[model samples]
Target: MPSETQLAYFLQQLLNAAPLSALYAMLAFGYSLSFALTKRADFTPGALFAFAGQVFVYFTAFGYDRLWLVYPAALALGVAASLAYTMLASTLTGSKVIRPLSQMSPNSVITASLAIMIVLMELVRIAANTRDLWLSPFLNQRITFWDHPGFPVVMTQIQIMNALAMAAIVFAAAYILQRSRQGRNWRAVSDDPFAAALLGIDPGRVIVFAGLTTAAFSAISGIMATAYYGSMDFGAGLMFGLKVVMIAAIGDQSSPARSAAGAALFGLAETFWGAYMPYVWRDLAMFSTLVVLAVVMRQERRV
Candidate 1:
């Protein structure tokens, strides 16, 4: 049995994990949506995530200094710029790269997507001049949930808001995927693009829809993450993208709800690992687990 202090600490850690889990779940939801359509593990979303966050930071800094604007005004401008550029990038990739290479092998698509990731990372690095930019923190007031003699469970206001926001987006996306006509088209295309095309559904258009929707998700998450963490670096995109890919692959990638659930579990695992184990080994352990799961699943399929 756990003591009062131990239980309180446990609760505190759980609360801390909520926001992280939500972020992973949100990214996985977006990734799974497009992965279903493309039938390939596209690395573009990760790059877009990093790109959008960095772009927001860059423009916000510009607006704050060059335009002599307040934080709110600068943030608004940053949001607008991030959304515009992310969607444009996603559209171009979907049309020029993803669509054109659809008939090629999955490895071909993965290679092209990785190449795009590198290009976007370079663009971000060059634009920032290899500088790390940061935002002023806001809504950081701590909210205590359970108070005890030696331990108290608490979370920041912003963390709670971000978690709630991610949950809303996931639920909304699941609803759209299950109940909407466009959702039907997305699933149909994922199952059989040729059959969908024969049914008068343009597979290319479905891919465009997935791209745009995913861009929106990436932009929202990127902006929020930058606002919360004060900074987003160039290398974060690929790592985040890869982590979400692994999480989504563990779930039914074609189903948003299942993917989100899987991501949430990953998030909790990460948080718990950080708390109980050597923090340095957190990523290595989680990643190793994912790799093992992938290999086992493959072997099962073969059997």
Candidate 2:
């Protein structure tokens, strides 16, 4: 049996892990959703995430401290911009003109996605006239759960919102995928596009829906991240996007639930590692674990 101190430390870790896990889960879902249609990972979401924040902050700055109007306008513009990027990516990947080429070389799709990411990031940098942008902190209020000698568990409103948003997104995705006609169409298309088309389900329509849904996930997560950190850099999205792709791939990309679970596990590992280990070893430890897991998974598949 563990002592009270051990339990306290564990609880503290859980509190710290929740928001990061939620963010990772949202990103992973974006990757999974896009992959369901294209059968390839889409790197576009990361760029969209960064672009969403930049657009939101840029619009909000115009409001001159009037949050009521600023917030709505900023959100609308941000979501619209993100969805536009998604539509572009969907068209590039699913258009009849490109489909033949992409089918011949799947890497062509990845290359196009990378190109989209680069172009968007560049556009955001030019629009902002800088690589970094900051937003005024909206929810800095904290709620303390427990206080111990060396373990204090407290969360901000933004953190709670992040977790809640993630939960809501997951439930909504599950319900739509399992209970809706469009969801059934998406699944059928993913399983076999030719068969789905024969059944009167249009693969192009499914692809567009996947892209839009994934974009919404990325945009919401971008908004939450900016709200939590109060600032963002143009280059941050690439690393975030790649990490999400890795997490989803490792988690069994076909299942959203598994991808979410993988993200939660990653969050817990990162939190505990940060808490217990030196800062220098933080990323190294986490990534090394991921590599080992990937190798093990690959071997299991072969066996």
Candidate 3:
């Protein structure tokens, strides 16, 4: 049996890790969505994540002080921007120009994705004046619970909403992939585009659909992240995108559910490390584990 102090510490870590885990899960899902169709991790989502948050901030700033009206406007703009980018990236990558190259070499598709990410990030920087943009602080209020001697667990309203949103997104993605006709089409294309097309499914259309869905996931993630942090920085999206890629790689890029599970585990590890270890070593420790996982996965695939 654990002592009271140990139990309190564990509970505190759980509360702190919940929101971060949800964010990683959603981000990993976005990666999985694109991978399902292209068999390549889509770096486009990193830009979309940053773009959505920046656009949201821009629109809210444009609205001046009328938050009720501005918030919706901001959300719409962010969603639109994310969708637009996803479409463009998906179409280009799936186009005849890039599709042939993708078949010959995975590097080609990854390069295109990286290029798109850079372009979008530059665009965002230009629009946001290369600075950290702020959002209204309404969601930053914390709700304290589970009071203990020298250990109190607290969660922000935004964090709660973020957690709920992640759950819904994950559920919806699983449902679509598992039960829906469109999802069946996506899987068919994923398995073999030529074969799927022979069966009358448009591979292009399925790819586009997958890209759009992934964009939607990234848009929601960006919005929630901005709301939770109360600010958006230029590099946040890039870092986030990279982290999700790591999580997906560690979990298995081919399986979104597995990737999400890996993300949750990573989140838990991160929380515990932050609480118990020095802050500087936290990322090193997490990333070292990721490297080990990647190697193990590679060896497993070989077997």
Candidate 4:
């Protein structure tokens, strides 16, 4: 017979899984927006994100824990790093022959993004010195919720903050994309850069701005991930960034919201499968799912 402890553990997993999944969904959407606008993933987003936690730690190390400053400092760093990435990628895209040959298509833009990611990783390794990195809880606080007797769930203020931050970004991004002139221009550029350019829209600026905006959001994801969990390597962005890419790909890059859903689903699948399956074969299962999804989707895409 199943014990009460077993039942409680099951419930606990569900509760934890839901919030984590939601976080994945939000981060995935952030990356999706970047890919949607610029057709490239910001590979260095995690470094900027991890840097945010380090910034918080650095400020705290300097004895500055002003709640107001935490996000601002993080945002500033994210903007700076992501903006540089955007500019560099734009220069690369402008030089690529595929764009001119294909009349400014996604192929060259994506290639530029890949190149930019490699550069960002090397730079992060140089800048951070590859030493120990981590962040103590920003709040040093915890919360408890009880669904029933013996079914209490515990979480930290940082996790709560992550949840809130995800909510704010989602609502804000949706509103801006739906009701702004810049948003319309972004949509136009996304559909066909050549058409947008003929309309007197500088495709170069659009791509850079799009990359910049996405990088900014990616930074937010990094900071949230690091601040919530504490510390990350310069190379940590690769797995996380690729995960975002996979989520976007699974969504067929059609609907950003659906991409978010794919992210959540991916997170849940990863978490659950990792637990039930052997450690050695863990990724085999997760990635195999992605492979199958890709094959099926590609066939559908052709049709």
TM-score of each: 0.95, 0.86, 0.86, 0.75
> Which regions of candidate 2 fall more than 4 Å away from where they truly are?
1-7, 65-104, 149-151
lDDT of 2: 0.74
RMSD of each: 1.7, 3.4, 3.2, 5.0
Range of the 10 consecutive residues with the lowest summed lDDT in candidate 3: 89-98
lDDT of 1 by residue, 120-236 (tens): 888988988999988888799989898777887888999999999988999898998899999999989999999999999999888778878887888788888787788888888
- Runs in model 1 with CA error above 4 Å? 299-303
List candidate 4 stretches off by more than 4 Å.
1-7, 37-115, 147-151, 197-202
The TM-score of predicted model 4 comes to 0.75
lDDT of 4 by residue, 1-303 (tens): 246756766656655566567666766666666566555544444434444444433443333243444654654544454445444444454445324633556555455445555565565556546555455445648677645455556667777777677757766776787789877877788888799989998877765565556556665665566666666565655566666667667875645677777877787777776656786887777778887896787688799
Whichever of 2 and 3 has more TM-score, that candidate is: 3
Candidate 3 vs candidate 4: the TM-score winner is: 3
lDDT of 2 by residue, 145-237 (tens): 877666566788888988888878877887788899988888899899999999999998887778777777877787677767776677877
**TM-score of model 3 vs. true structure:** 0.86
Q: Model 2 compared with the native: what TM-score?
A: 0.86
Give Cα distance to truth, residue 204, candidate 4, Å: 3.5
lDDT of candidate 2 at residue 102, scale 0 to 100 = 66
Better of 1 and 2 by TM-score: 1
